[model samples]
Target chain A: MLAFVITTVLCFITYLLLTTGSGTLGLWSLEEILVGAILSLIVGSLARTIFVKDNFRMLNPVRWIIFIAYVIGPFFVAMAKANVDVAYRVITGKINPGIVKISPDLKTDFGITMLANSITLTPGTLSVDVDEDKNDLYVHWINVKKKALEKKPVNYRYVCGKFPNWIRRIAE
Target chain B: MIFNLIIYILLAIGVFFNLLAGVGLLRFPDVYTRLHAGTKCTTFGSIFICGSVILIGLRMWYTGSTDGSVLAIHTIFALVAILLTNPTGAHAIARAAHRSGVAPVRAVVDDLQNNTLKKEEEK
Candidate 1:
């Protein structure tokens, strides 16, 4: 029930965003809103179970704010730094490419997914696989540092630089 | 004039990174490294390009154009879609490559395979 409502709201918001200024009203016409509502309701009923299983905690506004802050803040900085690093490597042909395993130990599926996505999104590292039992991520790192491969307790700073912590805050 | 200049600069930077991504794709050694170049660089470049468009829309809105807000908002939706989808697609490609037996260049360990074996033994 809650999932249905959440999905409906989300879908409607997406519909509204996509259909911005298509109507006689300020943003949407009454007829368009009706059509959007019907469409969103159909979508919500269909995908509610898949989207929000039992994790209503993730629907919290605070987590969303934190996620927004993360994107605009540390993640942005990390991406810029990664772009510079990748650009240098591309220009100079200096790269030590290898795959290594890092154990993030995030329990929730959403947390693990977010971390994996973050790792893959940031340059120089691509998440190649995951150990489902132990929650370890095998990442293909473009410049494999000796410190990263020493199998030390996986430092979030070294592997993904603050991504795990931020993901924990948002999803876990 | 200043806004156009900034937008042009952003567009140039976006194009530059995209060009570097193409260069890296050709020059990099293997599948994994090539994926890095192909995915992240384009994503970053697209971000800047979309951002410049959003700026243009905002400037138009400030000049009393009603269509500007709609343009800006829709561009944001596109940006969000790109940001969300690109990395996941890259991850899928990387995982598929690894599963299909594409090893990294000069890799020292295969912990993923080791862990899978360990799990199988435990079962």
Candidate 2:
């Protein structure tokens, strides 16, 4: 609870700083800041309690820094590459047009969300759905792989794109 | 001068990503893939665009323009609304597509269909 309060305070302070400069808050702005702060505290506490009910392992600063770096680095890199590939395909009309399944060996829901977000952010791929039981992602790829690819209309891969590994580093 | 430069850069980044999103939507195959390109890219691109507007608002506020301040603040709220709603809407569309049986082009194993089957069997 103490940590939650600290986080809430920090979040409110950051919000204030980003939204309005320091030490010059007018009465109206002060009221806004106070309201925002109260809301932040309530939301922060609720979010912490609900999301971190069982484990608060993700709150570590080191893990967060590493995660941010991973997301901004390799994940962005993959997105860039995909963007180029997509552009080329669009210009040349070389897209294979297929859907493939990717089972990125992820344990947590956060990991899955990261992977899905990464894929969705990329230019040519769409994360269709997830199999909640086995935790597999149904992805629709612009260009399905040749060898591993079958025409069965339902393919899943353990390692299809560079997305899974990058997301693994970032979120898992 | 420096502030204007930052705003221009932000606008450029935002416009580039927005164009990418549009291009992806046009070029990508299938409904789901097009939706992916159309939604996420625009969301990211719009962030930078709205961010530039926010900076412009701050600059105007400093220069004592009430209209500029209002414009900037309203734009920020609009951006927030977009950010909150876009992805959730996209997810809903994708799920609808899957339920409607829009299978991946060359998919080998469909865990979603299998899951449905399993649920039916359990029932």
Candidate 3:
């Protein structure tokens, strides 16, 4: 029931966001609202099982606020630096590439997924595969660091700086 | 005038990074590196481009054009979609490439290869 409601609301929001400026009826026409509600209901019912993933923690308003802050704050700075790093590597043509595994110790699939995606977009790393049972990520690091690999599993910091910690706050 | 100036600067930086992505794509050695170029650079570049559009919309809204809010909001939604989907798609591609035995060129190490071999043996 919760899943259904969440999905319905999310779908309706997406529909509304897409169809803005359509009419003067409070930024939507009566027809648009009716069509959106009916469409969202259909989508909501179909995706209810998959949409929520048996997790209600993500629906927390506090997590959403943290997520926005992370995006606007550290995440944006890291991305800008990543672009400059990539630009430097492109110009220098000096790369020591390798795939190394790291255990992030995240309990949930969402956390692992978020970490992997963050690694992929950040400096010097691309997520290539996962060890699902162990919750380990196999990252292709553009510049392999000797210090990180001294451990059994490479440290996440050498690949992504403080991202898993932030994701733990937001997702875990 | 100031808003247009800001928009122009954003557009310039966005275009430069996008073109640099193209250059990196052509120069990179292998699949994963190519993805680094194709995905990250484009995402960064698109942020600036979409941001400029959002700024334009904001300026218009402040100047009493009601349509501006819709324009800005919709562009933001599009930007969010790109941010969410681009890296996921690249991850899929990287996984597929590794699974198909397309090895990273001149790699110093490959932990995924061991996992694949172990999985294959189990199968």
lDDT of each: 0.84, 0.67, 0.90
lDDT of 1: 0.84
Q: Candidate 3: where are CA atoms >4 Å away?
A: none
User: How many backbone clashes does every candidate have?
Assistant: 0, 8, 0
Q: Per-prediction DockQ, in order?
A: 0.68, 0.31, 0.79
Q: lDDT at A106 for candidate 3? A: 88
Error of 2 at A76 (Å): 2.2
On lDDT, the leading prediction is 3
**TM-score of each candidate's B chain against the true B chain:** 0.88, 0.86, 0.97
Give the per-residue lDDT of model 3 (tens digit) for A41-113: 9999999999898779998899999988988998888888889999998999889999999888888998898
- Predicted candidate 2 versus true structure: per-residue lDDT over A11-117, tens digit per residue: 77656544553234641367668787898888778676654545556667877887768656766575566656655665665655554556677878887876676
Cα miss at B12, model 2 (Å)? Answer: 4.4
**TM match of model 3 to true structure:** 0.96
Error of 2 at B45 (Å): 3.3
Tens digits of per-residue lDDT for model 2, B96-121 = 88777776544434446665567678
Q: How close is each model in CA RMSD to the real structure? A: 2.1, 4.9, 1.3
Query: Candidate 2: misplaced stretches above 4 Å?
Result: A2-7, A10-48, A150-172, B1-13, B23-29, B47-51, B54-89, B104-123
Best by TM-score: 3
